[model samples]
Structure formats: C-alpha cells, structure tokens
Target: MKTANEKKNKMTTSEKTSKYLMPNFGVRDFVVSGGKGSWLFDDKGEKYLDFGAGIAVTCLGHAHPRWAKAVAKQAAEIAHCSNLYMTRQQADLAEKLVEKLGPGKMFFCNSGTEANEALIKAARLYGKKVTGAEGKKFRIVSAIDGFHGRTLGALAATAQEKIQKGFAPILQGFSYAKYNDLKSFEEQMGDDVAAILIEPVQGESGVTPADPKFLKGLKALCKKHGALLLFDEVQCGIGRGGAFLTSQKMGVKPDGVSLAKGLGGGFPIGAVWLAKPVQDIFTPGTHGTTFGGNPLACAAALETLNVIEKEKLCENASKMGERLGRGLEKIAKKYPGKIRLTRGVGLMRAVLFTEQYPNAAVCKKLRENKLILIPAGCNALRFLPPLNVKASEVDKALNIFEKTIERL
Candidate 1:
C-alpha cells in the first residue's frame, strides 16, 4: 500500500549506499540522517550512540544549538569567498587562534590533509632558505606509524606502506624513525633533514601517546640539527587529547602545529599555526584557497572553540576519558590474553585485541549490533566521543560495550 516515494524512502539504505560510493573506503550499513547531543539517527529512524563523533570532528556534540545557529546565520550572509579579498570571519578566527595559541600565525585550509600539506611545504621552504638546501637536501624525518594525510606531500610524510602501496612513487623527502625512541631519532637527525613531523599521540596507531622525554629530546635534536619540529595535531589537537594543544601538556613547543578534525565542529576547515619566526613562509601570492575559510565553516569553528571553553568540555573530556580507560582496563583484565593494551587521553582511547592483527571482523560485529566503533592500528578499537558527552551517556555506552566485549 506504499506510494513510489514512500517505497523509495522505505527501501534499505545499504542497498543504495553500497552501489553508489567509491570502493576505496569501507563503510558500515548505517544510513544516518540527523544528530543531536551525543547521538545520531539513521534514515530508518534507528537511534545510534555516537562515540566516534565523525572521527573527532563534532567536538561540542552533534548539532550544538549555538553552533547550528552560527552556521545558519553565516549561510544566510555568505557561504563561499576567495582569499583574494579581506574576510572578517577569517580574520577574526585567525586573530582568536593566534591569541589562544600564542605568538603564532595561521593559514586556513579545508581538511587535516591540507593543513599537513601546508606544513610540509613550509618546512621544505624553510630548509631551502635557511639550510641552503635548494632541492637536494629537502628530506624530512617523520615518526613511524604516523598518519599525516592522503595527499602526495602528506602521504609521503606518512609512514604506513599499506596505505601508500598503490599510490607508489610518492613525493620525496620523508625518512621514518621509531616512535618514542630518542636513539633512533638521533640516528636519523642528519644535515639533510628539513623537519621532523610527528603526532603527539598516534591516533591512527591505536592512540599511542608519545613519551615526553622522547619529545623533549627530539625538540633539542631538531634545534641542534636546525630542523623544524612540526606537530601533526590533526587528530589530537583542538582538545582531542584533553588539551587545546598536546605539545602544551608535554611542555615542549613545536615550531608548527597542523590542525583540523575537531576545529569546525563537523564543518570543513583546517588551520596551521606557525611560530613568529616562520610566519612569513607563505607570502600573499605564494599559496591560497578558494573555500578554506568560507563564512559558514568559520562560524562553526568559532562556536566550537567558544563552546569547548565556556562549557568546560575539555575538563569533562579529561574526567570521562579517565573513567572510560579505567572501565576498559577492567574489561581487559577479565580477558587476559585476548586484550593487549589501552592507550588514550581525554576522550580519545583505543583497545587492541591480542588474538588477531587488525581484526575488522570484531568491528563488523560491533556495527551489526549497532554499537558503532572502529578498529585502530593493527588490532584495536577506538572510542572518540564528543567532548561534552555526559557521564550518563558514558554509562550507556559502557553497557553496550560490555555486551559487545562479552560476545567477542
């Protein structure tokens, strides 16, 4: 008794989703339509507890009222504009970022990868200018298992070969070193090294936190070698690791910080903060973007920052992250050989299955149960809930998680 439109709407979304999308990325069979607070709703009206939060993009929770209002107002005013002209939204956002981040300049872009790419370019330019390496000595030292981006420059900097296999003949100037190993880093810190880019916590590598001593040692090494120390905070910054900037928590300042993911509260935007010394790496005509700081995205980013500060979401994140980690530890203790480790900070955490490597099947089953979690690193699961998620919500998620773990 259904009409054509009604029938079309009633049809299973996975049928169409699998048929239409590119085959490169794997997707679960969830057709999400709307979101609010810390929950997402599917097209079929099924409710989902969102712990992923779009890979840490919705930091203030999905569709925060103030953020939504800001986006709506900006959309009504103007959505797209080029960097050729002066934009108040972009200017104001940059000023706020520099003020909070301290003594640094900013360049707006569209995603984490773009932000990283810009950082890479800036480092190479610095190498060429200061190190007297015109073209030959432009190599950069990066941590193994680091995830920069998919673009040529960023991917070249990324240390994972599985992601870089077919994208062979990647852009040059990237050397890999052991993460949290000062001796390994020291061995690689040579004259040709342009910069040493690293993530404070390796999110894609199962939320592994870098050692503080190692980071400080690397900072000193970079200074000794005249190489810029760049922090790829795309996944760990904007309060992802419980702090505005992860380096601040470690008490070691990097020359540059690349950020995105959580910056725009689900809106598309990336920002790179450079210290005062390297501020002029990209002159006016050297680099630009068409829609990087479009009014809509800036509005969303501004609200996200304000909400995180005013709502004390960072503090909430720290408290809840500890709670989640403790609960996960109990789970790990119950299942001795099956669970290997738990690493994370704030709201970012991961648990690895010891039995198998990169157990996508476990995640597949979790998705089937509608619990919604993804595997990290070689054999782990990541939990990246919104920063403002309530303790009660964590309890609910833990219940579902316990059930799922028991089945596993």
Candidate 2:
C-alpha cells in the first residue's frame, strides 16, 4: 500500500470521499488519522483542536482508554448478535440505564433521528391506546427552530423549511408552536396534541436553551391536555449541558427523552428513555431495531457512562462551558457590532453574528484554519468541544476564535 503522503499527493481526500460517500453531508475534505483528548490529527500530520467533537458526539474526549478497551473487549467477545436472542451485554446495559434514570425503560437505536422517530411512534401509540386519540388526534407539537432529525417523522417535526423542502407530502399530524413562548404553546395544546417534543438546548438552531418557565409550563400544559412531554436531549444529555438530564435540573420530569450524540462516546447509539408509565407502552415486537443494542454498542455505551461517572465530565462541562461562555461574552462585547449573541449550556454553545458578518462566512474561516465547527440556523456559529477540553485548550481556542471574529 502506498504511504499517506504518496497517496495524498496522488488523490485528494475530497476525491476519495466524494467518489465513495453520499452527498447528504458536507464533508470537510480532511482525512482524519486519529484523535487524543480534545484534538484531532489529519493524515497530513496537521493538528486541530476539534471544537465540534463530531457534532457533539465525543463527550469524553477522543480515543480514551476506557472506550478503546470497551471496543476491543466487546469485539473479541461478541461484536454483534441479533435482538432475537437476549444478549448479556444488552441486558446489562439496559439495567444500567434503568438504574440511572430510575423507573424508566430504554429502547436503543443508532442515531438521534432514529431515537426521535421511535419516540414519535410511541407517543402516537399511547395516544391511540390510552387517550383513544387515533389518527386525527395523534398530532405532535414542536417548537420553532427545533431540530429533531431528518427522518420522515422527525423531519416533519423539524421546524426548518429548508430541510423539509422537496420532501413534499411530509408526515402529517405535526404542528409548530413558538419556542420560548408559552402563549403560543398553550394555544396549540389541545385534545389532538398527543405530545410536545422539544430540545433542552436547541443544538442546531444555535444553542438556545429552553427557559425554565417554558419547560415547567410545557409539562403542566401536557398534563392538562393529556399529552406526553418529550425532551430531545440528543445534544444536551450525557453530561453535555451540565447534567445527565438537563430537564431534571430544572425540576421537570418529561414523559419521554430521546438521546444520541455522546451517549456512546462517538460510537453510533441512540436511546429513547421513557418514564415509568410510558415505559410499558411498547410490548414485544411493538418496536424494534437491528443495531440498537448490539454488544459492541452496548459495551461502548456502558463504559462511556462509567467514564463520565468516574471523570466527572458533567462538572468539567459546567466549568469549561462557563469559562467558554464568559470568554465568548467578552468577545461579543468587544465586537458587539459583529458578534450579536452567545447562548449555550455546558459545551454546547453558539455565537450568533450580525447579518453583516454571516455565520457561514465565520464557519468557513474557522474551517480554513483546520478548526472543525458547524453553523447553526442562519447566523449562528456552533461549538461543541469535548467535555474534557482543558483550560489551556479552551484559552487557545478563544484566541483562534478571536482571530476568526476579528477578521470579520
């Protein structure tokens, strides 16, 4: 086999990826070699402090020992087995999640979109069974600018029109309610509303956290209207936003929670956690997934949880997130005309720029410097560094961020 430099010179990374992969995602054209902690190394040996963490997926940093061991051990033992027969790893992982959530059950999947898809299904099923609200009454109410996923069911719940465009005749029975506005949500709440789906921190539309008042009030409204409250914790859960369950810190117990991203510490895993009563809604064969709780994924997730517990990533996320936020605020104040707002929780943060300095431009600049980031909404710069991103790394990132903003 030709060496990297020899091969890199012959065929660009972009060439290989574009020729092989689907065009659904915007690939950065960087052939990543490896990562350690908060940084990633390209095949060219260029170092980049990854602030995006693969879009907020690697919470415990990269290539950690725990994860490496879990993957290795599980692979050697049993990489994958169908959900037909019960697997020990699967049972142990489920039991562990049950213990963590307390009086809840778990349905494993492989992506946030799939988790949301399952949650949507369960809510409709509950509506049909419990409330006797069949086809017409099984409507989902989601907040504007909220991103559930790209699957048809979750896509229909997504608020952004650009994503849903051309996918004509979307999944029906979904309604949009104004985010952070209870009056709008109240108006939308009715017998037809089977569930209200929301993100604790809107990761895609910039990291705008849901107000406690809106969350608490949404729960009350759900209860009053006999609708289940679903929290799309895909981006905020598993110590991303300073808590295991961010809604819990606000003292609200949602009936359903969809999680992915960091759940498997970079491995593909998504879970829909259900409250006690809501747990029993799905009987055998009622819902299923092929790769949801396979031994490889379960082992990775089990160890990911352990690493979070042992390393106290939640505490680290809180401290680093505050430091990052404060630094961003200072930058925003210094460049008030360009930097419009900075909003986020823990490591999940976004810096919205004035229309004069577009978010896409800022994102492009960041990527040019080999820094990986993503644009949220139309004018927001999203950042989701690893939970273990150090103070030194944070400081360096701030400098890079400042330089990037100054150029604008």
Candidate 3:
C-alpha cells in the first residue's frame, strides 16, 4: 500500500550497498551522511562520536574549512595534469617532505600500498646496484605480523598468512622475522637481503609499537650488511605518533620511509622518502604513476602538513596521548579481568579485550552507543582520534567506553 517514493525512502543504505558493492567488507548498518570535527551523522540524523577517524586517515577531522578551501582552490586552478609535466605544487610538496624527512628525494603515489610498492622497487634497484646483478641480491626481510599491502608485490612483503592466503605464488625472495627481536632479524639478514621492511607502530595488529632499542639495533645491523632499513609509517607518520615520523621520535634514521593515510587529511595521496645514499638509484624510465603527485593531490598534502605545523597539532597529540593513556589504564584497572592490556603511542592506541569479550562484539556495542571504533587484530579495538581532538572530547569518549564495558 506504500507509494513508490515512500518505498524508495524506506530502503536502507546497507541494503543498497549489499546489492551494488562487492562483499569484501563486513558492512555495518551505520550509514554516514556527513561529518564535522570528531563526529559523524548517520542517514537518520543521529550523530556519533568518531574515534576511528576513518582508520586514522582524517587527521584534520571531517570537512575542515581550511583543508576544504585549499582543495577547492587547487581544483579550480588545476586538478589532474598527469605526471607527464611537473607543477609548482608538486615541487613545493616534495621540497617540504625532503626537508622534514632529512636528505631524501620524494616519490608520490595514490595510497599507502602504492608507496610501499615503490619502496620495494627502490630496494631491489639498490640491491642490483650494489651487487652488480639483477636477481641475485633481491631478497627482503619483513616482520612476521607486518602488513605492507594487498598487491602481489606488497603482499609478498607482508608476512601475515591471513592476508596472503588466497594470493598464490607471491613474489619470491621475502623472509620473515619476529617483531622486536634483533637476533631474529640478524638471522634473516645476509649479503643477498636487499632491505628489512617493518612498521614502527603496527597499527593494524593491535597498535604495538616497536621498541626504540630494537629499531636502533636494526639500523646498525643494516649498516653492517649493506642492507636498507625501511619503516612503513603509513599509519604512524604525519603527526600521528606525536612526531612527524616515528623514526625521528625514536632517534633512529631509516634508509627509506613509506607514508600515506593522514598525509592527505582524507584526500587520496601517498609518498616514499628515500635517503640521499639510495636516492639516485631509480632512473627516469624505471618507475612511474599517471596520477601520482598531480597538482590537486599535492595541494591537499601540502596544506595538511602546513596545518599540522601551524596549529601545533603534534604537540597536542603528545599531551592528549598522555591523557588518553591514563584514562585507558584506569579503565583497565576498574575491570580487572575484562581487558588484557592497553597499548599504543600518541593518538594511535588500542584496548585488547580478554578472550571472553571479542573485539567485534565490543566494537558493535560501542557503535550502538554512538561511539565508533575500529577493530584491530584478533581482540583489540583501536582508538585513533584526530590529532586536534580536545580533552573534553576524550573524556566524553572515555565515559561512553566505560559505560559500554560495564554493560558487557
């Protein structure tokens, strides 16, 4: 008995997504229409506090006026001219990144996966340069739980069996090492190994941070063996770790760094920074991307970095990180056996629940309470709020989290 318009209006967004899109993601019922700073509005006009921040991609929060304005201005001027010709925006962005990351050259891409892939290729080229052979010295050693990307080349670098399950015949010459174990990496390293790739802060695998001493050890080891030390900072860089790069905060210099996510503040962009020693390894025709470092993408990334510095968001992240850490610890104490542990650095944090309460269940309950979170690993939920998040917002989120835990 319903009219056609009414029937159409009654159809939920989840239903449309299920019908039209691939079933790769475990789609939730929440349908986001719009968002403001630290908050998202569902199609029903219900607002939810967004702690996940689009998986740590929205560093400036939703619809930031300055960011939006810069993107609009750039789009009006020029959007995609391809990588055939260079633009001032691209040049300026590259200069800024090189200055921040030390003596390095920058290569732009469209996502973290692409950035990591570029680094892998750079490592291979360096290997061939050093050994004077193509496939002889092209092995890469990565952490057992580290995640590089979904592409075959990147997936081979990633050591998780779950992520690499269906992808057969993954690129060869990749080795695995235990995270935070210097001896394990030493065993994997040899004259044939080109580089060691790892995440300083493993965001996807429960927000575990690499020990400072461990990273320093790897640096020395790489130097001893003429192997490159590459940090996958895709999730922890660009002010997320209370510093521009986690390697900088730890005082360990890596040969190369791959970054994305927060770099564009919700816009799609990625970059790889290679130190001067290996910077010239890539020739003109060796690698290229059509949309990488275009004017519009460079504009977004440049403005994102500018805002972070001007607003002192990195300093804010440090302070708020301390506050959030204390809050999580207190909650952990309140429910003795419920939480196994809480860990992370800066705004990238996680709460590992006991086996009794699964991460998915807790995430669902938090979403039901209008507090969104991202499930990580097997039993942890990540809290990756924006860098500019206020103390009051942190308190509100904590209160909601505590209430949800009590109910469970």
Candidate 4:
C-alpha cells in the first residue's frame, strides 16, 4: 500500500511548489510533514535530526507542548487587535523582556527586519535630538560581512555586495567597518555618526563571535562619540547563545538591541529594546505596527520565555555547547587541514573548511545522511541545535559528521 507521503510525492515538483510560492528559495526535495524535539519527519515518514533548529528560530524545538498550548489558547481567546489598544499579554511580554535585558522600553514588531528598522529610526531621532538638525549626525556604521535583513533600510545597513545587488540607491546614511577590528570602526566614527550597529555573534558571517574587549571598547567609543550602540541579537539572543542576550554574557550593554528569531518560539514576533536614554524617543505617531504586540504572538513568546526559565534551557545550552565544541575540536584534529577552524558561543557554532573541501557538497551529504545543518558564509557549516538537545543527539550528529568527513 502506498503511504500518504508516497502519494504526495507522486505530484510533480512544479505542482508541489512552483505554482504558489515565489522562486526565490531553492526548494529542497522532500516535504516536511511534522517535527518533534530535535527531530523532523518528512512526508515519507523519514526522520532527520534537526541541528539547524529552523535556522535558529525554533530554540525550544518543534512541537513544544507548552508553547503549542499557549498559542492555541490565545488564538481561541483573541488573536489580534490593532496597537491602538493594549493587551495584557503584550504588557506581560514586554515586562519579561525588560527583566531579561536591562532597563528599556520595547517596541514590538513582526520580524527581525522591523525590529532593526525601528532601531535605525530611534538612532536617527536621537541624532536629530542631539544635533538639532535632521540628517546631520545620522550616518550609521555597520560591519562588513554582517547580515541584518532584506528590507531596504536593513539591506542598506548590511554591507554585503551580493545582498545589495539590484537594490540600488539604498537608503543613505550607512557606512561599513570591518568586523573584530576596532581601528576600522574608529576610522568611521565622526561627529556625524549617530549609531554603531553590529551583531554580538556574526551569525551569517560564519558564527564569528565579537571579542569581549572589542565589544567593551566599542561601547566606550559610542559613548565618546555620543552615538548609540545597537546590537542585532536577532539570531543570537533568546538563550540560543546561553544567555537571554549575548551582550549580557559578554558583559557589554548597548543603547538599543533588536531581537526576533527564537523570541516567539515558532510564532512570528520581533522587538527593539531601547535604554533609558533613548526609550522615550519614540513618542506617539513616531512609529507603530498593526499586528505587532498582538495577543497571540505575545502569548506564545511569554510561554516560550516561561519554558526557557522553567527548563533551565540556558544552562543546558552552555553545557551542551561545551560538549559539542569539544567533540568538534576532536574531529578537526582528526582532519587537520580539511577542517580549518571551529568557532561560536553556546550552541551557535560553525566549522570552517579549507578551500579544497566543498562546504556545499558536504552539507548536502549531511542532509542525505539525515543530519541537517545550515550553510553559513565563508565556506562554513553551522550547527544550531536546540537549547534542550540531549548529549546523545550531539553524539549522533557527530558520528554522522565524522563518517561524512572520512568519506571526503
């Protein structure tokens, strides 16, 4: 008898996806049917270990009982109302986020790009307030090879040529600095520079972490130049980096921080937290979102936070990250020249490869072997397992990785 997945697979590829979805993404072969903690099942009932965690969004993992219940319950009661009115769930979520991060007022949005756009607007407003002129002191400095988002403002802030291609005349007032190089950043700073935006861990640029000293120095520089420091924690926050905020773990504070990805577990939500100095910058009519801070999203986020705290997932992430790192180091040692380096914090990790090794091919093979990983920039493979992943799952993934490397 043909299984349900078999029947579904019988449909042509074009019929399955080409009709409705845009052709931007390269659609994979199999159709995902369902997922559980640390695992995903395709339409054919074949299971694969989930190390990518839906590109680091599903921090608590798939089909989490608590998150599911909270989202469903909230949806049943009330899903959304325009931001004109306040909801208890939104207030609760904002309070929780403030408690995790330092004193700040939050503006809720629907995605990371929106969060970052808000940060940009806040910085621009701060600049206008300081200089008593619009467009003066509004230039924002961002690091090269950093990925912010696809929106026009965020895209302009992003320094990659490939991302900026075809999006000409990108919103002005943006400049680029080299990551991890304080001097490169210093050269860009001036009286007109309003903000320095960067990711604590450069998730898209091969999981490169910002040095503690560099972050501290950057904070000092921002203070000296009277500019705001914006940390894009869209991918590294929400306990994925073993801290509520990666900057918290690094002992550095920024004037504004953007968060999304894992913040809502599986649901869509985004937020920007502004420190006391800039919290009041966005007064009425300054900025707003229609579905942001809606009851359903907040309920999901609140429950996600609750689960992270109750399960001690942050501690688990630290422990598992250490174990995963040690295992990767061992593998790197075994394959000396082929494996260039391994870098990251908590579970947000990457293994870079030598030019001779094809990262894309190896990643494809790993997927064939039922182990999923994210292909990061700079010829690196990223491993973003769930915070609550077990040691045995790590071992299993390592075993598959070793076999693949051996074959190479």
Whole-model lDDT values for every prediction: 0.85, 0.88, 0.92, 0.93
Order by TM-score, highest first: 3, 4, 2, 1
Please provide TM-scores, in order, for all candidate models, with all chains considered together. 0.94, 0.95, 0.97, 0.96
For 1-408, candidate 3 gives per-residue lDDT tens digits of: 999889877877877788778988866677789999899999889999999999999999999889999999999999999888879999999999999999979999999999999999999999999999899788999998898888888899889989999878889989999999999999998989899999999888789999999999999988888999999999999999999997799899999999999999999999999999888877999999999999999999999999999999999888898899999999998997889889898999999999999999899999999999999995999999999999999999999999999889
RMSD of each: 2.4, 2.7, 1.8, 2.9
Q: Against the true structure, whose TM-score is highest?
A: 3
Error of 1 at 296 (Å): 1.4
- Lowest lDDT 10-residue stretch of candidate 3: 23-32
Off by over 4 Å in 1: 1-12, 356-358
Summarize candidate 2's per-residue lDDT along 1-408 as a digit string, tens digits: 899878767876789788777988876556789999988998889888899899999988899988998899999999888788788877888898788776889999999999999999999998998756578559999989999999899999998898899898999898998999999999988888889999987888878889998899999999998999999999888888887877876678899999899999999999988999889888887899888889899999999998998988889999999999999999999999998888888888888889898787788788777677778885898889998889999988898999987876
Which scores greater on TM-score, model 2 or model 4? 4
lDDT of 4 at 240: 84
TM-score of 4: 0.96
Greater-TM-score candidate between 3 and 4: 3
Candidate 2: worst-modelled 10 consecutive residues by lDDT: 128-137
Total residue pair clashes for candidate 2: 0
Off by over 4 Å in 4: 1-14
Q: Write the per-residue lDDT of candidate 4 for residues 258-377, one digit (tens) a residue.
A: 999999998999999999878999988989899998999999999999999999999999899989999999999999878998989999999999999878888989989999999999
